[model samples]
Target: MQELQNVVSTAFANIVASGAIEKAVEEKLQKTITDAIDSELRSYSDFGKIIGERIKQSLQINFDTLGLPGYNELILKIVSQQLEANMSSALTEHIQERMAELLAPAPSAIELSALVTEFIKLETERAGHTPTSDEFTLIVKRDTSIRSMRFEYVYLDPDAYKSEYQCKYQIRIVDGVVSNVTFNEVDPSKKLFIGRLYGFERRLFQLYAAGTELILDDETKEISTYYPHCD
Candidate 1:
């Protein structure tokens, strides 16, 4: 269980360093999130019945209505792509609007931050353990105009023992492709970037040409975070 917690923490950190994500596990998380958001959107739209019918009708017949690969499956696979390659305030507003449809109005930044922090804390508590000091300072950036994400988490004990992770993701909507992704770090240096990029090339195309964008979510949560942004 401790290993799983570490893996989860490391996984998020890897996403921060390399703007890329996998299609499998990401979907599971998104499903829960989407369900909540969808309820909110439905309430706001006031056309919940109609919209629900549309969702069922659209998806029940035409496979394309489901969205890429397999609709739900594709959403899991491509959500990170959207985060890395096509992020923007407009996207955030749109999502917020969707949330408003079924849930209460969007939470303020402070409220959102508190919610996120509590959620993470709850996860740690559920595991019957505590996140290390550095794990408390997680950072996440999402940009909609270009769609991508970058995030990091670090743990440095008072004795100077340290563990860190970073991940970055880039998505290309034009071709429905992931252009680049890299994660994991020990002693970071310039040379490390090359190896990270090389590993990404195995799965993506022309990743070297892209410049990553990291847009902080003002609503992010924190606990004992070292960075002002995380705090």
Candidate 2:
């Protein structure tokens, strides 16, 4: 396996040489090939020259096509959406097969959130971007076993496009298992949050009207929740 330092330094070199960052840094802000990389990776000098070219090649292609200025923001939005869609399709297929094998009779409720998280893991593998864990807060509720839930949300960069949007969605979950997932942004409205959701969607999950945390017991399948308004 390639060391992390070599990979990053190579990636930086490619970025600089590709003209992505070059336009941003002029003569006054000149940076050496070594200075472009972080010091922490200095010790890994052995791997730098050998693996650097591979890293540079891979990074240059994407930066050349997707980086700001190189490509319009709208195009980047489309690329992101397509990638998300591909990831979602792949995730859904894996989840379906895995769930069948794991649950013989099939569980009563599959948490969509849990399944979605799992799908994201798989999708990240396929995309081969820097492996990163998904980080976004999600809240859901259901009176009965959740049949399925889908989450969609969008984020917009106001400066990029006055009329564009980014959209994402999570799919089919019984109880709470997420069966499918995707992340995408597009040029759309100014809305900070927007998306489609199905299967027992809640603005927020409140254990009680009194506004309290809800605790669940795995063994008993019992829930103890409190809401502030109830009190």
Write candidate 1's Cα lDDT for 30-103 as tens digits: 99899877876773565777777778787776667745475787787788778766777777887776444323
Best by lDDT: 1
Please, what are the lDDT tens digits per residue for candidate 2 over residues 1-231?
A: 468888999999999889977576664265554565644355467556547766877777555655555357778988999999889989799777654533334233433343333334443344334322223223233444333543322121111222222323222222233333233432112334334422212111111111222222242222111111222
Local distance difference test, each candidate: 0.42, 0.38
User: Candidate 2, after superposition: displacement of residue 14 in Å?
Assistant: 99
Model 1, runs deviating above 4 Å: 1-111, 144-231
Q: Give, for candidate 2, the lowest lDDT window spanning 10 residues.
A: 200-209
Q: Each candidate: how many clashes?
A: 45, 29
How far residue 148's Cα lies from its native spot in candidate 1, in Å, is 13
lDDT at residue 220 of model 2 (Cα atoms): 23
